[model samples]
Target: MGKPTGFIEYDRIPSPVRDPLTRTRDWNEYSLPMPVVDLQIQAARCMDCGVPFCHTGEEIKNGVSGCPLHNLIPEWNDAVYRGEWREALDLLLKTNNFPEFTGRVCPAPCEGSCTVAISEPAVGIKSIEKAIIDRGFEEGWIQAQAPQKRTGKRIAIIGSGPAGLACADQLNKAAHNVTVFEKSDRIGGLLMYGIPTMKLEKDSINRRVNLMAEEGVEFVTNIEAGKDIPMAQLKAEYDSVVLATGAGNARDVKLPGRDAKGIHFAVDYLTQSIKDNLDNGGVQTLSAEGKNVIVIGGGDTGADCVATALRQGAKSIYQFGLRDKLPDLRAIQNPWPQYPKVFQMDYAHSEAEAVYGADPRQYLVNSTEFIKNEKGELTGLRTIDVDHVDAERNLVEVPNSEKIWDAEIVLIAIGFAGATPSIFKDFKVAKTNRHTIEAAKGFYRTDVEGIFACGDARYGQSLVVTAINEGREAAREVDFYLMGETFLP
Candidate 1:
């Protein structure tokens, strides 16, 4: 530890973000960098606990407790505190393939499980992480480091999201020739499209993708496997195929007027919004401007929709979550070291409240039907309040509690079901009941030989850090399969 009693001397100070009211006017990133001194002070708060659960990366109950990437948190914190910026960056890159991505968007479960959090506020681990990576870039410490030797094996990776990118980076580092395929016009699947620019700017993604390209990894955009290119063709050309396509098949709501205009899935809405912003100079083809937008779901995606709508000048905004409101403090069931299910205002919520003078979230409400006019354009929706029943936490709609609200646009942000089933039609690989690829526990190999699945395609929807872990591990497995020896770590 850089400073043994530093935790006692320093208080937690998070990195500042752009003002909610002012930041909504533009599509730029909202997070502002913390000063080096303040960041170092925050890092000093990392206690020298013998058992640091911050990087345990385990799932307790239904939620992940720590960083899924198993980041060396304390080590990097010590390095940062000692003003060894290069050393901190080195330690960070050893575990996380894309700290810039996870540091921005990942809901830091690492902080939740921090031993310091048991007493005081948790260390600003995510902020420190972003600082280290950002500094690495500014100082030119991060650059293309192509493998000195080649293994002479050709690898084709489907999907260019975090998982696919991480897998490609590792396999390329192991000296294998790797090519990544993406269906979109750009490389990053979720990072490029699904997330709004105010959270993670697209330039960050492009910067990393450029570095990877310079390192000898080939990127093929506007190419989708099982469509323009068949699985059979890839299998014949490449020594092995790794499926890193993310889970983006949105869960549709079956209700009256679901086919109505102005109703869209969250992923589709977000993807289109970002694309329009990039291509059409902020004139969104599918604009939410002046419309009373209703977002049906509660999570980061739904919040993103709310934030995007705000930037597009939405007249009114409302987000409905089926679950009950979380408590202000951790519940008894949610013990220490578990990711706390507590109430906290996310950035989007803050922005919405700044504009609307209220949080805009309605909890414990389930949508019943989408109200629409004869022209089949969404007008609003009906919902009923639900109450929790028994220890099992089953939901029961409260009688005579139906309500309706005025809305012109509806975005379904419920969640993704899993990978697109159509992609697997040609592969003939087994799929789970949940629609994910049927890979063995702790292994990425599919029933079909020479093919493997990882990331959201294998584990369903997960965090960016988890997807990176899946990609790195799958690369190790593929390396072992190709050369009968594994060196990727």
Candidate 2:
């Protein structure tokens, strides 16, 4: 929109990243910032289509296509193209309460539905977003904007993940006193611990948490609501309560030797790594050095395991997925404007390939059991080939396809099932058959009056953007419940 022919004249460019070999030595962010001028050029690539599917944030069958926060993508893209960074930041913050987190870690479905992507590569919308927020910080434009008047209403938000933070931000803006309770030692919940530092640095989370604190949002850490603190106290003290606790009960693989000592859950391993990196002078309690590491899932968490193992100087690493290899390009079943689940190298896989001789991912493989040593420590794994049929059919394990691979340590990266036990019992919230909080789709309210839920706890989650959207929607509902009206737009 800035220059009528900018989409034709300019090509999409991603932010520069350090060479994989050079970056794995430490747990620091590797993506180098794109220059302001180059970012502007990339922003110029937005066609800002009449339909603007990029901001519609709707899900089509199995895939989501656009920004779930309904971010003013076109407006901000134009503002960035014209060097109005302050305005761009304002527009971004209008919907997404935390751009710093999403800009770094979100998969950027907005690009998948971009009007420009129909013909050519999509504009570097994610990189432009990151640059806008980074520049906002650098130029002192980002600050604490506490409300001038208080409605004298109080709200308690359980869990300090993205959803809770987003809800607190909006509620505070509505002049309500908000307090976020986190079970972990620090705020930011999964953002602080569950995710690896290489992708989203801890400092970025700290920056936002500090700002939120200045804006009068109180954060209490190490006090779990169901255990250390009582849920009755929370319910009695606050006018309303919002349950934003994420779904953290990890799904476990039921194998013959699952009780082996060296086998760990992906969340546990990742949390320990983050704790070691942030607190203990970078001394890891469980190092994968000189060992054969096997990651038993191929999602983002499994990829993170690969990268962390590489950083720990593991001798070898292998990642296994039950599904067949995805096509490098979109398949016939997947059409335009849908997020393609095609094969691509994430940062960790890129780093693993750089250090090892080849990519560490193996498709259509399933771990049968953990092979152990005399001391009951994990020494290796037994795996077999698997075939997926229709939804009604079971996974058929191929005969004569079993194999054993040396594995000193095994990390299970299978996804989570639902919220942890304490959240459900403490709050007494109703749950669906899937064990997630029972909330009608898009309406994040519980059967109990004055109680609400959102994020992974509400919808079981698909992405961080979805969680942010849930938080925004939940805040609107909470506002209406309290004041009989709302102004959350």
Candidate 3:
């Protein structure tokens, strides 16, 4: 789909990040932009494979290959290769509503499944995507696209995160009057608060939100749908309701003295830190200043805590994980086309190591207890070295391998437990065994008529791209339910 010999001539080029030492001092986005010429060269590397697996994003059971949204990778790659920036933007926006957010934050499963990755590195598909969209914005090619006519229908969207926003964007384009309800004081649910600004600057979110408003989508913030406004009122007012409240229930690290004063959930800690930085113009409250910090759970959330702590002037940081470390290269069972299961570095991990002079992660360590001081403040964490054993390979502590980690603040970044029931208290929507909203097996409809759920609330915690896909799908369903048929793509 690209130049005939492009893959053979051009090597894969990675997007570069700002200097770690300097970037750690602020919360601004740390990644630098690539010039369009270099980006086109990267796009030229897409080889003409018999079939494209980059965007056949399905249940992903076989492995994490294919784009969940089934993004038109080859089409857009060819456009970028020809310097057809506008065409590339149109193709990208066809599947993804917010490439700007995904460009900065998404893990890029698209690259992992790229046909070229079978031999050489995949085409710089993601970078080309970011470049195309960014170029579109720079040249004022993107604008508020109001529908030509009104469908005379209304849709109420709960939550302003990726899913909520995507659904709102689609439903609005279908000429439905859409109102997005957010419990927080601002738009962009987790996108606004849970994620650190450096990953996705709030300015970008504000810009899209403002454009949505111009296009006739209403955003109401600081109002809980169930508590502030009853579900009955919304049901009576809107033709359909979309519940996109993300799965926000944080998984707890069960250990003695779990209620220690310094213990914090990863999302809450990150939210407060980000809100404080945005509102107060600096990290005021929840500052990690001059304190020994121990972060439990070595996932993306944990990595974020480490970076936040670094920016807050932390004394020292340590991330503990009960699971064994991954291999540097892909294992035999983990083959190509599947998302690479090899050990890799993220922005926060790189920044932590560069600034702290050491990798902050320690694997195979299980936290057994939290040691607190006389006043009930966290002082340290007691843990034990463990190994995987038994038929289930459950973690087993090694005898005489106990150790106490010195710390003042402990951030639990163990992940989420799906959506909580209290938010759905009024809707009366049933939940599945996995604790997510119960909808059609292959659709976004709920048991209740005219009610729908998508994104993390329905699928459990997932990537931003997955959420966008679900939202779009749900909007299509809602539109069909309203009009008895829909032109929503």
**TM-score of predicted structure 2:** 0.97
TM-scores of the candidates are 0.99, 0.97, 0.98
Clashing pairs in 3: 54-67, 55-67, 55-70
Worst 10 residues of 1 by lDDT: 420-429
Residue 308 lDDT in model 1?
Answer: 94
Per residue, candidate 2 scores C-alpha lDDT tens digits across 242-293 of 9999988899999988888889998899899999998899998988999999
User: Across residues 1-489, which tens digit of lDDT does each residue of candidate 3 receive?
Assistant: 769789899999988679988999999998889887788888888886758888877545445577888888899889888888889989999999999888888888988888888888888777777777788899999899999899889899999999999999999999999999999998987888887888889999999999999999999999989878898899899899999999977899888999889999989999998889889878469988999999999888888899999999999999998888889877777777788887877788888899888889999998999999889999999999999898587988899999998899999999888897785577889888877888863479988888999999998988888888889999999988899898988
Candidate 3 error regions (>4 Å): 390-392
Please identify which of the two predictions, 1 or 3, would achieve the higher TM-score against the true structure.
1
All models: lDDT? 0.92, 0.88, 0.88
For model 1, residues 1-489, the per-residue Cα lDDT tens digits are 988888899998867999999999999999999999999999899986988999999989988998988999999999999999999999999999999999899899999999999988899999999999999999999989999999999999999999999999999999999999998899998989898889999999999999999999999999878789998899999999999888978899999778888998898999999998889888888889999999999898999999999999999999999988899999999989999999989999999999999998999999999998988888989999999988899999999999998889999999989988886796788999999999974679999899999999999998888999999999999999999999788
For this target, which candidate reaches the highest TM-score against the unseen true structure? 1
Q: Candidate 2, which ten residues in sequence have the lowest lDDT sum?
A: 387-396
